[model samples]
Target: MSRIILHAGMHKTGTSSIQAMLNSNRDSLRNNDWEYVFLPKDAKAAYGYIHSSPDSCTYSEAKKELEGIISGSDCKNFIFSSEDMTAALQSEDLWVSKGERVSQLFESLGNIEVLIYYRRQDSFYESAFQQRAKEGVPLNFKETLKRLPIMSSMDWYSKFKFFESCFSDSKFTYISYEKAYGGIGITGSFLKYASLNDIIPIDHSKSDNASSKILTKIFAEYGPILDPHDQSLLSDVLCEYERAGDFRRYRLLSLEDRLSVFENYYQSNRNLYSICENADVVDLDIWRADLLNEYSNDYRNAVDDKDIIIDLLKLISATQK
Candidate 1:
């Protein structure tokens, strides 16, 4: 009857850092009566069955798969983390059924706690697009936005209600990515929330999750032409610049556009706040102010080819040293 904690990352909410931190401290965490289950093979397939198609697999079979995966773990508690779970929940045709399946899949494990971190709608939209762009999706930012399933993804209230209803007997914790993660940083905030006091020093300098705005732009414009090898080199060059603090801010959304994102999801956000007892009107207002200030100056700022060439030369010279 060990407790089960699931970190269901609603993407672009610092999930990578959190996962990296957990893995780095896995042994220490295990020593402290908690086990972090790494899922990329067998467990991922098992999770996908429950997350994508509810009626595809029986609850008993799913439970057996999970139990088998963690067979040797002697920890008092278990943690499963995956951001892809949020993608399944964002599918318009599958969210509700998936939610029910997810609940049922874990029903055998007593005292299940589902933890989710949600970013602001506007920020979430932009971040998600940027992620696709970084992966060399050749579409421009605006076109990318056109293809996102915004209604299903941004309707936080509806999703929250579905999750609450499905997990009626379990605990569901919803956290605001912007408002909730204070100065302690996302990884620190997560550990705090999970009630873990282990002080595992993470070297943020080498974090792989930090995306380069310059790299995103280059990929968006030239991804189709560049082969895998070229793309990898380009990424390395861009990342070098990013690490040296020489990259410029890239914002494809205008101030007006970002504001409109919030406006479009305004009512849903309010309704979401109604259910979340810790949410406050002041937090909403502050979030708006932060968004406005952050996006006011950067809108479709083009990267200069000459500057990139110069930086590329600089990188090559340094490498030759």
Candidate 2:
């Protein structure tokens, strides 16, 4: 049976890691009879086609393109991933309510599996806020957490529920973001479940990119705080970076600020975990401590030979190229 796997990210839960892995190893994945459809190369092309024609990009039209791609490919397993899907959850309108767009998409697939990876709320929220900060929109942890509803206006649970309502629970598998450490294990699980293990070789070297939290904090604090006009400019630059496959450095919060932020995240995640008992929530403090230890010991030890600032410049160059 043909299978469709949808890896809908909850954001900041190593979604980029997964996307990078898929992109860097597309050929191998395809050889294993599994096709990963990224936007523009896959679904994004359909989204663009729909946006351009307006009328031609209807749910039916988009579904036809997706079906054609899947059917024409030799792969029996299809994988689609996008963090944008998370926005669908917080939407006021259900997937069905948004015309027949979602329904058509689902109907086009033979066997569909929805995959989600959620982090403890605090960690997810803090990381998300820090991301916004790097974009020059600084919001303290408390304020950012307060805006969770607005951030997730699409009703986070609704997106998954939409699929669940249409498909069985067996068709959905939610993993913990914590399990995504080092990237290989998560990809292995995905391959195993997709039954493409025979085709796709698990390459650990491909998962070499690292987002320096230290650099991220610096950018968050010092990057130009963008207003409307500035934001547009920054967005353009970031888009270019994305196209060039270069990762940007994020600003960091001060030591005091970092601790404050962590505290807020800890409290908030504890509450969220209490309410969402079904979620596989990992403790943020534990993860944070582990990262700290790794950075202080392993990362520093490895890079001790080079000047930290010079190394950062090298990273920037490598990413841009």
Candidate 3:
């Protein structure tokens, strides 16, 4: 029986880069005695989503699907990476909790190892908002926050218990995603985790998982701030930014607000650290983090135009079916 390694995602904690690296280096990884299973990017077939569902049948279905994947593979080491798998690991669903999903789905597989990355809850959701924006959600920072499921309520203790139930705590390679705490980039850091460092060295700059120039450009100019009242103007800016990749000073969030986010999730995170030995919940007291906008003051000096507002009610009368 070959060993199985799973990378369950704490979304927005650099899972994309890790998955991209594993995908691009699949052939090389196989040469090194590891095979990374490819799953559909989205929807029901996506085991990540199914494994976390409260529906019991989904687990059995996932188990069947997984067995099919493994039966076809000849490699001794198999890798399954999905951020969706841990979506609500801390929450208990009526039918099945996320941890129980893992337990039921892989109960027959025997021994397994898991790799997970933990990020400050506030910081994780902040990055997550930007990701949705890139996908054309047309929502500002705060709007996205309201639309997202409650993240601050997530219980890390339950999450840690969930993974440990499926795969023993000792088999997890938990990494904290704080730079000062030795949070290196995925490709740069995970080779040693997978024991593939001796066989293949990676140049992450070329990894498929890296963020796009349009996004990087936007991040450099503005942080996450957007004008919701100026929908037309904001839309125009959004379109042009994607097409032209322009640079400007944008507001990501306020220092006070960011701190509040840290404070809000602080106790819950501490609870996680107390239960899980594999992860080091960040020490926010001394940990300094980055903001999206560097020139927040510059934007404050600018004025807004009230006349530019376009009333959709008025536009409704201007058009006819």
- C-alpha RMSD of each candidate structure in angstroms: 4.7, 7.7, 7.0
My TM-score estimates for the predictions, one after another, are 0.79, 0.61, 0.69
Q: After superposition, how far is residue 266 of candidate 1 from its true place, in Å?
A: 1.0
User: Model 2 over residues 157-271: C-alpha lDDT tens digits?
Assistant: 4444555665553367766565554445666656565666666665545442224344334344334554555444444444444445434333233334555555555544444
Reference-based lDDT, residue 169, model 1 = 84
lDDT of each: 0.70, 0.56, 0.58
Instruction: After the best TM-score superposition of candidate 1, give how far the Cα of residue 207 lies from its true spot, in angstroms.
Output: 7.6
lDDT (10s digit) by residue, model 3, range 1-321:
668877776677777777888888888887877888644452244355355435424545667777767776667778778776676553556214556666566556645777787776666665666666555445556555556674535555566665676555337666776541243456666676777777668454532312233343233233335444434344444454356433333335556667777677667767775555655555765543433343353664232322222332234234322
Off by over 4 Å in 1: 39-45, 51-58, 69-71, 150-152, 180-182, 199-211, 218-240, 278-306, 309-321
Ranking by TM-score: 1, 3, 2
Q: Model 3 — TM-score against the truth?
A: 0.69
Better model by lDDT: candidate 1 vs candidate 2: 1
* Cα lDDT over the full model 2: 0.56
Lowest lDDT sum, 10 consecutive residues, model 3, at: 301-310
Error of 1 at 317 (Å): 16
Clashing pairs in 1: none
Which window of 10 residues has the lowest lDDT sum in candidate 2?
Answer: 299-308
